[model samples]
Target chain A: MKTKLFAVPYIIWMALFVCIPIVLIVVYAFTNDAGAFTFENFKGMTSYASVFGRSFLLAAIATIICILIGYPLSIVMSKFPSNWQKIFTMLIMLPMWMNFLLRTYAWMSILEKTGLISQLLGLVGLPPLDIINTNTAVVIGMVYNFLPFMVLPIYSVVTKIDRSLIEAAQDLGATPGKVFKKVTLPLSLPGVLSGITMVFVPAVSTFVISQLLGGGKHMLLGDLIEMQFLGTAYNPHLGSAIALVMMIIVIICLRIMNRFGDGEGQAVIL
Target chain B: MKNMKKIIALLLAVCCVGAVMAGCGSGSSAGTNGEVTVCNWGEYIDEDVLDQFEEETGIKVNYTYFNSNETLYSTLNTGGASYDVIIPSDYMISRLIDEGMLEQLDFANIPNYALIDDQYKGLEYDPDELYSVPYMGGTVGIIYNTTMIEDEITGWSALFDPRYEGDILMFDNPRDALGIALLYLGYSLNTESEAELNEAYALLEQQKPLVQAYVMDQIFDKLESGEAAIGPYYAGDYLTMIENNPDLAFVVPEEGTNQFVDAMCIPKGSENKANAEAFINFMCETDVCLANMDMIGYTSANAEACEIYAQELDEEAAAIMFPSEEVINRCEVFKNLSPEALAMYDALWTKLKSGA
Candidate 1:
């Protein structure tokens, strides 16, 4: 009876949000270049492999950058005092509460020529840096926006660890670095895995930040999917095909993370 | 599990019933008599035109705005949108008509089609004048700050000049970006040859480092603030931006740019066709079109509005509303390309945008 109740909510939720859209996307993906139902849209994807390849490569680079930056920040956030941590946590989340478009717009204001940053740089006699629309700017925006999601999960697992274990390592003649390496790290592996999953997955689909801050320069997987919906792809079905592939890639990433991701340095190294 | 299964079945039944009701509501999209929802770009319309249309027709008018064409396309295409009339650019309008997304315009309702110029008629996409009515027309050009630069920045090459590295902005659009590259190569904006595309892509990659920002609406703000010295934008939008900032100046680049016309169309599935048509006819009125021109600062297609342009705006300012044939000839209107060509352009654009 409980299993049936669980199934009820799950089915309703999926029906309302996920399954319906997926069905629409699948039908559309098989549509012709003119957007009528046909098989040509799928065939179009192969002839344009570089688009998919470039999208995949950009997503991978963004994912790797997120992991590299997120891991340390999450680990540090996990070690903060409870009351202070809660305040710090909200401070981290404050930026996200602002509209995503607004945040990216804010970056443009800061990065543009004669922008506040550039003016300030000129005042100090350093030459202006044109960061807007660059891949580097896109990566910076990703790290800024997604760092909090990475921090929370690691913090959750770190808070649950028994501090006595770290003390035990210290009492047994372990250094502070050794205690973290052997004791706290192994225990916090679950949180790290969760954090990595949270950061990497969402970062792959980040379109607005890249569009706004990347100066229309970077075409990530998210932007490609958007092109289909906007009729720029010349075929709705092709857009659907691209989106379906992107979804599959995301699922694969999740599965891989579940299989081998760990916070423990030993498990991570192995 | 048996008890829960019954509850689950009941929930599914309830949801299905709700969906069926919603389906029926959507099916009655052609309105007999109800409100007509009009969605357009923010600050792009004359509010009085909307008011006068509502006043004359007695069809309740609900208006909303989008900041970009992509946003407009996505919102209208969402199908749940209640918009009876939408304004999209030439390319987007062509794309919609190609997809059978636009409703056939009944000429009996909009007899004022004669108000449209002969030159505007018989364009490639709406050749038979079946679906769309031209609203406002303009071309993309360079808007700049005269105070910032000493050189007369006459061509696309001026944009790439590194001396203005932090001062240069570009339109944050693949079409505009790609078109500029193609034009610089003395090719058509619709070129799709692999070699030409690769050449354009390479140029875009090189130019990326020089752009301070890829801006759309904010390009106006950036220009006003002196955040950027020059960027590509529609001539009508540039007119308004210059109005607000007297220091700003705009010109058609010596090489060329794309001319565009935004048109009004009714969607096939709108529930309020009567109200939609009434609103379209109302907008066609000389007074209404003039009011729309006043609010939007764009050149209205209504000949009457063009005649009244001087009365509404001083001669110097009104002159910007109309461009000479020499200026028109310097630019080309974007044509609907074949699917293969579109895909090739998209592919090159993708690599240019992503690879860098």
Candidate 2:
């Protein structure tokens, strides 16, 4: 009875913030400006499928790049003494403390045609990089901003990994590479799946990073929804409709990942 | 253990309630006997003038800001705040009037209304001069880097010229972007016809490949740093940009441009209507208006204020900021678009950004 009572506050918090807002979005999704129920909102998504496809493609690319970079980094850090590991982890996490918008703006100045990186390259007799307003810059921004999210989860799981299992594999006739692939790879599936989800979800929904870095030429799903509500478009019902589609897509992605990981992704959470 | 759980639950509930209360805390007491709340654009008014208004009038001024006119409209629509005064652009003023959301101003309380120039008065949005008091006015023009281009920039043609490809910055907002296209094609800025809008859309689509980026306030850094060579920006912003980059120049394109006026009015829900009028009256005083124009770098709507500062104002700066009467005559103000027209803009803008 006491344990059941303890869950009340959390249930209330979830209901107020998460569940209620989703309910409102769903409600607005099916209604028109005149408050009449309609299916036109859902039908309108067909015209914007290209926008959804582009955002998903860019976000997937960013997530894949983050995994490639962050997995090795966390693995190397896991080999350090636990005390030094904490210091190195803090160094990685320090940039996350600053506002993400300011960080993206800093990237803007560093990547511009005549900005710092270009000046440094010119000094080294190398060509200037002209990627500030390009899709590549946006992907770089997504990976940079969400890399820590990928690292922290995978690091926690890798550090908590049992040490005796590696010794056990070594005792057998298995070579170092075969033992590691057979043992380490299977065990870390949960962490990698969760890391992919962690990076993918926010990257797909982000508007600010793309707006500041992508130079407003690229219209992602997030920017489309924002324009409907706040920009000159001024249609909350349409905005909510787009929000519903985005939520559905994200939830579907999460479910597929969960199924593939055999529901172990949930357990990997710290 | 049960008692401990109960105590923890109580602590959590108390914390939630405290947070809710803190968020609901009022910035100032509601306008009742002697208080007045004025909501305007962020950084639109000089803070010193606000202090002087409080000194001259005994009423307490509660000032707040909104970044865009849409935000102001939504706040009022939701009844989220009861603002005694609001400063909105000309098109928004039309929307507010159409909805009967504004209070009809009593000119008796604002005798300083005589200071307004004849040109700023009786605009299409408020033809009767019964609602809005013109605060500041400006037109849209181009700001370019003098060192980058040798040829003279005559008009909107410069924005689309092939030589400046990948070196031009365009406005990100749909209204301004479409407005520029319409002006370039010699159509009314407020065109509601689908054919005309499509023409504007085609022009923008053709120019999309050449644009360095679509930007808003980012123009400041881009132009000053020479990151982009030419940009279409408000005439007033040119003054602020040139102070940092002496290589910059502003032009009021010979083809014509957009002239906009942001004005002050009281919403219908205002409680202290009289006090709001007094605040508007205070804003029109020659010294008060002059100080505001100096800080903001926009042209003054008050004739007396302009005359008083005429000697001190730089001649070249004045010409760029406020063009001659011939140029002003050629400019048109934006009107509120109907729902169908707005939807057309949204669809076209999405297609433009998607490159499909």
Candidate 3:
């Protein structure tokens, strides 16, 4: 009874911040500016199908790049001595402590025509890197900012795997590679799934990255929704509808990934 | 022991609820004469002016900022905050008036209203001269790195010139970007016609390949560092930029451009109307306006204050910063669009951005 009583504050907080906002979004999504019931918001969203496609495509590419870089780094970090692992983990998290906007702005300077990279390349008699206002810069920003989310989860899970189980596989005349693949890989599935969710969700929904690095040349789902509310468009009904659709799509994507990861990933999703 | 733990848990929950209620209570109860909330553009005013206003009036100021007029509109439309005084552009003032969101100024309280230039008063946005007191005014023009582009830039066509391909920056917002395109095509900036707007859209689409990026405040960094060759931005900001990079030059294109005026107004339901009026009156004083002009590098709307500011500039600088009557004649102010027009702009802007 006391434990249940202790949860009252948390329940109130969740109701006020989380549950209420979601209900309001759903209500606004189905209504027009005059508060009349309407499906026009959704009907008009077909025009923005290209933005939806671009956002998901870029986010998926960023997520894949993060996994490619992070999975091996996490494995290597897990193999380090315990104290060394702690230092490496700290290094991975150090960049995140700074403001996210400041880090993105730093990349803007680094990727510009006369920026640090270009100057160094010039010193070597190479052409300047001209990728500042392109889709490539946005992808680089997503990978740089969200890479730690991918690394830390996999590292923690890989570190916590039972050492005795791996030794047991080794004793059964199994080669080192086979024992590691069959034992280590299966145990880390939950971590990898969670990491993908962490990286992909924020990457798809990020407006700042696309605006600052992508040069506002392309509209992503985040930019489209922002335009309706705060940009010149000023239509909250459409903004709410777009947000609802994006949320539904993201939820569907996570559901499929969870099923593919099997029952172990269910615990992480919750 | 369990009874003691229950008592502790009950106290913790009570404290949490009590704290939230306390926070909510404090914000809405500040309707007294000692406090006035003011919302203006980010980095728009000199901080010293705010401090001086507070010192002179003995009315504590709760200052806030919004980046764009649309953000300010949404903030008020949603009742997000209760601001006593708001400074917004001319078109937005007209929209707010149409929505009955603004209060008419008591000019008797603001005696300094007489100091505003006659040209700045009774304009289209506030035809009756009842609501707003003009604060700052400027024209949109091209700023270029003279070293990078040796060709003389005399008009908006320079933005589309392939000679400066991969070196041009354009406005990020739909209104300004489309407005420039309309001006380039010899259409009125405030045209409500669909065909005219579509023509503007096509011009912008054609120019997209030449543009290095679409930017707003970032134009400062890009132009000052010589990373971009040419772009269109406010003339006042060009003045600020040329100080950083001597290679920079500004021109009010031969084809006319936007002449924007930001004014101060009190929103309806203001808690301290008299205090807000006093603050606006204080801002109109010559010394105060001159101080702000110096800090922000924008042209002052106060006639005497503008003269004093122009005296400090040399002949060429003065001519560029304060264009002669001939150039001013060609410029047009933006008017508030109807709901249909605004929606069309939003749709067209989305299409342009998505590369559709």
Top DockQ hit: 3
Candidate 1 per-residue lDDT over residues B96-193, each given as its tens digit: 88878899888788888878767677776688889888888887877889999877878878787888876788866667788998888888887767
Which candidate leads in TM-score? 3
In model 1, the clashing pairs are A1-B1, A133-A214, A133-A215, B29-B270, B29-B271, B30-B271, B31-B271, B31-B272
As a whole number from 0 to 100, the lDDT of residue A126 in candidate 2 is: 91
Q: Rank order by DockQ, top first? A: 3, 2, 1
Tens-digit lDDT string for candidate 2 (B188-247): 899999999999999999999899999988899999999999999987788889899999
TM-score of each: 0.81, 0.91, 0.94
Which tens-of-lDDT digit does each residue in A101-220 have in candidate 1? Answer: 788778878876667888999999998776766777777777777777777777777778898987888899999899988887778777766666666666777788767777666566
Superposed model 1: Cα runs more than 4 Å off: A20-82, A164-175, A248-270, B1-33, B47-56, B64-82, B111-124, B155-168, B172-174, B181-215, B243-245, B312-315, B329-331
Docking class of 1: acceptable
Between candidates 2 and 3, name the one with more favorable TM-score: 3
Q: Could you give candidate 3's per-residue lDDT for residues A201-235 as a string of tens digits?
A: 99998988888888889888888888999876689
lDDT of candidates 1 onward, in order: 0.75, 0.88, 0.91
Q: Candidates 1 and 3: which is better by TM-score?
A: 3
| Native contacts kept, each candidate | 0.54, 0.66, 0.72
Each candidate's interface RMSD (Å, one decimal) is 3.3, 1.4, 1.3
Between the candidate structures 2 and 3, which one is better when assessed by lDDT?
Answer: 3
lDDT of 1 at A73: 70
